[model samples]
Each structure stands twice: as C-alpha cells, then as structure tokens.
Target: MRPKLVLFGDSITEASFSDGGWGASLAHLFARKADVILRGYSGYNTRWAVKILDKAMAGIGGDAESPAAVTVFFGANDASLPDQRCGFQHVPLEEYRENLRSIHAYFKKKWPSAAVIFIAPPPIDEEARIKYPSGQAERTNEAAGKFAKACIAVAKELSTPVIDTWSKMQEIPNWRKSTLSDGLHFTTLGNKVLFYQVVNILIDLGLSEEKLPADLPYFYEVDPNDPSKTFG
Candidate 1:
C-alpha cells in the first residue's frame, strides 16, 4: 500500500487548493506514492488544532514506513493583534507556544516514526489586510514572526523539519503585492512558490520517482493500438 502525506492547519490550509494551491502541488508530486490528505480547519489556531489532532489522526491509520510525511502549517490567526481583526481566534503568545508543542508531541506519539514537518505562517500585509467585510483589522508581519519563532522552537526541540515561510516571503520583491491575494490569502504565484518549497522538501525527504508507483503505464510501455492491454 502507498504511504500517506497529510496537510494540517487553518484557512491557509483549507484554501490550499484555491487558485493554484500548494496542496495540489503536493498531490501531483506524491502522485502514486502517497495520499495527500488536507485536514485544514479555517480560522483555527494551534490552540484549537491541538485539540483536534486525535480526530485528524483517526482518519488515517498508518504504521511506520507508510504515510511517510505530515506537514503542520499554522499561526496566522493566533498572531492576530488582540484589538484587531477576528480576535476570537487569537491565542496568547505563551499559549501559542505550548499549543504548537502539544501538536508536535501528539503527532509524534500517534504516528511513532512518521516524519513531521512544520511550516511557519507567511508574513501578513497590514495595508491590504485592513479590517474588511466584518472584523477589526490587520495581521502584522511582526506578530507572525513571533509565532514563527515559537514554531521554530518546537522544530528544534523535536528535531522536526520546519519551513520558515514568513522569512522567505519577505526575501521576495514586493511580496505583499505579488504573493498574497488579499494581504492574507495566497495568489497563484505564491502557491507556486509554496509548491516548490514543499515539493523540494518532500524530495529531500525521499519522495522520489523511485518511491512512487508509476502514475500509469509509461508512454514507452504503451501499445499504441491498444494501451488498455498494458494497464493493470
């Protein structure tokens, strides 16, 4: 049986397939090697996420060598300033730290030998993210960095891999305008960046052609007159 790859987090995760979608990129990369499962709960922070890990784990039962990877991406909402934009989801910094720790601990315990990777939330655009439609306002880059620090701490302690999206996005030119659609969500270009970043990581972690089953009969194996004859 093929192993599984799970993507877990909040809205960034829920919308992972939107536009060009990072999740879609992983799906194509894993192709026949694993099931890329999305377990994103829009607006959820690590506080809420820690509570839901068991439920998420229940959906996929895997031993050691299977389900090879799981990536945990979060923090945007938890870093929300208390006075601005959807404070309901904001978790205190200390709580956020512990929440992340709990999440990693649970994933490691539940899936004993599975490789767990963490993705720090990307920078937020305060200018474009003004409280719109209905909330207070703005998710600052400074705040997201703080949460990213917490995420990195968990990764270091557990020896898990982590992607510092918050910092990477900043390295790009005019990222606020080019990467995010609304200062919060990702644009298609941004998705490409994320796709490449994640796919490379998976590759480094052994998601190579050798590990995947042939997507289908290779073209060279095709019986032009009757390709079906070559299919299993």
Candidate 2:
C-alpha cells in the first residue's frame, strides 16, 4: 500500500494559484508512489492546525499501523497580527517554543508511527510591508525566522526532521523577484522551487524517493496576465 502524507499550513501552503499551491504540486510529484493529502487553510496558524488535527481524528478509528505522515507550517499569522487583543503580541519566545512542543507532542501521541516534518514559513519580501502599512509584515518575517530556529531546536529534542524552508528561501538571490505580485505568497514557480526543496529533504530522510522529474518548470518572469505568475 502507498504511504499517506499530509501537507498542512497556511495561505502559502494553500496556494490558490491557477496551477494549485505547492501542496497540490507535491501531490502530483508523488502521484506515482504515494498518496498525498493537502490539508492547508488560509490564514491558519499553529494553534489552528492543532485544532484541525483534533477535528480530523475525533471519533475516527485509526491506528499507528495505518498512520499518515504530516508536514506542518505555521508562525506567519501568529507573528503577523499584533497582540493587543489576545496579548499574543506580547507572547514571550519561550511561550512560542512551548506552543511548538505541545503541537509536536499532540501529533506524536496520536500517530506514534507517523513521520512529522516541521516546515518553517518562508521569508517575506520587503514589498509586503506596503499591504499592511503597519510594518507588521517585517516583524512577521523576523519572528517567523526566530520561530523556525526554535522549531529546529525542538526537533532536535524530539528527533523529528525539519524542512528549513526559511533558511533555504533566504539563499535565493532576489527572492522577491520570484514572489507573487502581492508580495505575500509564492508564484507557481516559487511553489515549484519549494516543492523541489521539500522533496529533497523527504528523500534524504528516507521518507520519499529521490527520483523526481528533472524538467520541472517555474515562473521565472512576472507575467501580468497570469495570476499564477505573481508571488511575494
């Protein structure tokens, strides 16, 4: 039987581009060998992801023998909005780490045999600041990076694998050029690049095969007519 892999995250993972988001692209890439499930929601944070998992498993009869792998990405929205209301804006770094730990623990207990890969949110381009005009986007980018590093530290404690998408994205020269026009999401090409990185990590960990296609295309240049061509 084919293995089951779930991609969970926010809008970026939800990628509503014409060609579908990175999760859908990943599903296509592994279509021949595995069953990929996209469970992303727009504007979802780690807190919401935890709740979603609870809802999925409530009353369902499943066990480790039929376990499903999960890839989780959050921290963007958590750091994006200010905390005057929930006071999460003032949430300490230690608390953030605790949140991650709780999330990992919850999934591990529920699906003991499943592989859980933590995915860090990608870096935000400077252009995104204009959309909010509150400078929260820049803060979100910084906080997301910190959150990624914190997740890495947590993974070491739990012995789980991480994709490190945040750092990989920083290495891309003029990454802003590859983003969607909105400057908050990735273009079709951006998602393709992300897929390549993710697949590589999965293969290195023996969770997936290394036999990926070589001629995968990405949107390198911005095309105003194509909605999929825009990425932040």
- Highest TM-score: which candidate? 1
lDDT of residue 181 for candidate 1: 87
Using all chains and alpha carbons, the TM-scores for the candidates as numbered come to 0.89, 0.76
Tens digits of per-residue lDDT, candidate 2, 1-232, equal 5667766677776663337567777677676666676666887766666667777545433673444577777766666545423234333567656777787887788777777888776766655554343434434567667777877787787888887777776676677667443555777666766788777777876766445332333445557687464553
Where does model 2 exceed 4 Å of error? Answer: 16-20, 57-61, 81-92, 132-140, 210-232
lDDT of 2: 0.66
Model 1: residues >4 Å from true position, as ranges? 64-66, 132-136, 209-211, 223-232
Worst ten-residue run, lDDT, model 2?
83-92
Best by the lDDT measure: 1
Q: Pairing residues by index, what is the TM-score of model 1?
A: 0.89
lDDT of each: 0.81, 0.66
Give the clash count for each candidate. Answer: 4, 9
